[model samples]
Target: MRYLMFRLAHISDPHLGPLPEATAWQLANKRIFGYVNWRRNRKGVLTTDTLDNLITDMQEQHPDHLAVTGDLVNLALPAEIANAKRWLTTLGSPEDVSVIPGNHDAYVPNARMKAEEAWRPFMSGDIAHSGPLTFPYLRVREKVAIIGVNSARATLPLLATGYFRKSQAKKLAKLLDECKEKGLFRVVMIHHPPLKRSTHWHKRLIGGSRFRKTLAKHGAELVLHGHTHLLTKDSTEGPNGRIPVICVPSASQGFGNSHKPAARFNLFDIDGEAGNWSCRLIERGYSSEDKLISELGNQMLSIPNG
Candidate 1:
């Protein structure tokens, strides 16, 4: 029997809102550098227009399954989570999509509960709660296995970090081992990159080294994440060689004056037999006359086995 190939659309860091006028003002007044960065890098501070454009572009791609890595809101406000839920509904049914919480989604003390309440409507199955296994759980398709993990949780005031508790790490190890034995094409998803070198102190995912060791042991075909809000790629060196880890920029971020193209999402096509995969970065923009533009293209890579 021939395994059916599945197409996955991966996007992250939309940072949706219940952004109050005051929040905008605070960003402008106190966080001047962050505000300037947002203006220069992201698309106009969370406008409905940005969401509309993203939804439109994603619809055009017609992904079989959608994976959102995290950071669905700027602040973990109940209302913001509600807004994110609505946006997710518009994208596709929750049954067709999988999402993990990001640092911003769990910013508040009751962040996880709030996210559960807001996001449960779109979640297809049970929320993984048994250690890191609560995430890193599997979504089995005809020929693909989508593994998701939760890396976002509330942290101290000074530290804006992501972490996977020890229990979760152990659970992830078991899950990977079991899935690999099944001969499935695995797509592992986390809000933070599995590699420590890809992150800095303030934004690092605590216990990242331990996590990487587990991932290296189990082996995954693809690893996707979105916490840094910048485009990056790293490889986890394994006994077999290297496994590709791909990070996408913020879906709602703008092109800015950096001359980079507007925000984009990735479409991945997996070959069942050859165990090969191809990806395209699809950019979303507006025409000079203010119409939406969809550009499908390839990104160059220099990795040895990527």
Candidate 2:
């Protein structure tokens, strides 16, 4: 660990939209379905007011770094992608923020390519290495090695699943080992949860078993993800002990009804050294009745000493 203390803020599944008006041509493909879903359900559920307020509060926290774990766009429309990039600029500069894509980011076949190009800066590592920007990409900030993995993929309509490729899994294991050698706090950021039971059959990660096996072989201090759009806290076996896997509700949602969750995000205050560290997770959100954003929970946790 290099820093005496570090503050990291995490938010996810913004699903940001008020979809840009489209021609019949634009909605010709699978987007036709997405358009209906957005207008009929998401339009009311994910409000810009809530998203703006959440972002305003997040900025006020002034965390050392911010991690947005994907679904930045809704329809993967050309305009939607452009708008999301602009929104990211408002959130923070590439130097202060990092992002990984969710399934929605790659909603259509060609959308993945566009997203990779549009969001490359946020996804790139500090030390530019060889090859295309690949999964298990590492950004070392102070003591934290924020590793980002790509799980987003274009799927058939009504299938919201993700896939963690075997090639990526192999690389991830090596990256985790590297972190252990450097004594950096390893935080794995993926759009989909690595746990098998994390999501429904239709939305689950396709190769989650392999991902978990990689973790069991290597190790990480923490795992943060979204996708499920619910507040989830569970544990998985690490080389040394149990590793905490946490998820927060969608960033743009209002306090949920039956179908959606409210807006929420997490601030992790991290400190201490390699093999001896302390991290306190502070969860904040705007509840259905709350007049303002406030802390919902706080818990002190320790990373297993390597």
Candidate 3:
């Protein structure tokens, strides 16, 4: 069978709207800052309307798979988590979509566990043998091997950091080698950018150096992430070549506020066999000039390390 190109749509940080009502207890912790931030600044910027428009445009493109990087909810409230479940179904079936968590999804000490319980299906691997789903999970789609890594963890007030555990790095190395031996294109998904200098001090990916060390040793075709809420294109060193590391803008960002780009999603067209694959990135999102969502641009991505 001649395998055709696999089109994967990537979006992140929806920060889904109309945060659930919270009592004093719920807002007493770090959530208070997030809550205040949401009410004062984010309420106007992160809108479901923008997210709906972006998703509508993305669905119209007919991607073979969808990858959501994280932050589906703000404050990680039970109601917010439940609402995210409903919003996810509207995106596609669990089988058609793969998701990871972001810092906001783990806004509290117990929030990450709650998110895991709620968004289990979207975070599961291909083979279902599990008591608890683990990170660096594997999902195969035709010629591609999707590796979902967990870097999300609750942080102190005013910090939006993520952590990549050493254990996950070891497992990720093994998975990379296994996928390489199988002749599958490896795509690693995480909530924060793997590059060390990708974000500010407060929002950097903790253990990013270790994450890059693993990729340098084993190599991968592509890396997708979302946290800085900016449209970014950068590369990290791989064993044989450079691996493309990409991050998209928030899926629900409006036009006026913030220095970040307006809401956008990318469609990556991946093709070719293991050693000689090709990929292209087509970006579509809102334009601040006219506040209209349209095809922003496209670029041919670098191939995987040999």
Candidate 4:
């Protein structure tokens, strides 16, 4: 029997653009601050051209699935959300892409809801879900079980925090167990890092302890997130052992400064079976010298046997 490896591509914080025109009412709340910040700080840095090039290269790799961790829009404006749907479609079909909401997607009250309505196809599970979409949704592909948890929510000005409720914790625990029972490679995707102290206090995941507790109890093969817009590799306690948590830079960032890095994405090759699984992570992004995307490095991720 031939063992076919699954190629999964991970990209986050695209912040997809050409910021649509917004009315005064749309900018009245937290969006006002985001609008100003985008205009002054991010407008020049995050560009669709950069994302296009990066995605073009990613498509050349012919990944089996794509995981978008979020921040597909800048202001969460209606037009921006609609455009993001089109962008996702151009990137891949709904069956091949899975998305979770980011803080920016919920920049203001009900903004995340709008995103849900527009991007439901990409975010929904394989099974039919009644009413509104729920977090910790499950999508099993081949031998991999992809679980999506939404941590994004509307916040006050200057706040980019994420939240993981007890409700989600319960559902996630159940999902993790179900996946494990099936002998599947469980991969959890969340917008915010679940590891404590992984991000600053103001921009941290509020219920990270609860999230971590759930993982510690239930266990998972890997966790993927994107919010810091910087490459990060961290791990947390799991029932079996330390579970690897990974993050990538903003997918739309055109160039890197001393502080913020350039656009990048990860390609994960998942293979093996229960109790003896294997995964290799390949980092690909802009080469500062030529200002072109290329393979940066690769590593074999530690997979704790459950």
Estimate the TM-score for candidate 3.
0.98
Instruction: Tell me how candidate 4 scores on lDDT.
Output: 0.92
Instruction: For candidate 4, write residues 1-306 as lDDT tens digits.
Output: 235899999999999888988999988888888899888888878988899999999999999999999899999999999899999999889999999999999988999999998999999988968789998899999999999999999998998999999999999999999999999999999999888788888999999999999999999999999999989998989999999999999998876355878899999999988898899999999987798999998999998996
Off by over 4 Å in 2: 129-132
Poorly placed runs, candidate 3 (over 4 Å): none
Candidate 2: residue pairs that collide: none
How many times do residue backbones clash in model 1?
4
Worst 10 residues of 4 by lDDT: 252-261
Give lDDT tens digits, candidate 3, residues 69-152. Answer: 999999999999999999999999999999999999999998988998899999998987667779899999999999999999
| Per-residue lDDT of 34 in model 3 | 90
Whole-model lDDT per candidate: 0.68, 0.88, 0.92, 0.92
Answer with 2 or 4, whichever has the higher TM-score: 4
Error of 2 at 31 (Å): 1.3
Question: How many residue pairs clash in model 4?
Answer: 0
Better of 1 and 4 by lDDT: 4
Residue 116 displacement in candidate 3 (angstroms): 0.8
Clashing residue pairs in candidate 3 are: none
> TM-score for all predictions?
0.81, 0.96, 0.98, 0.98
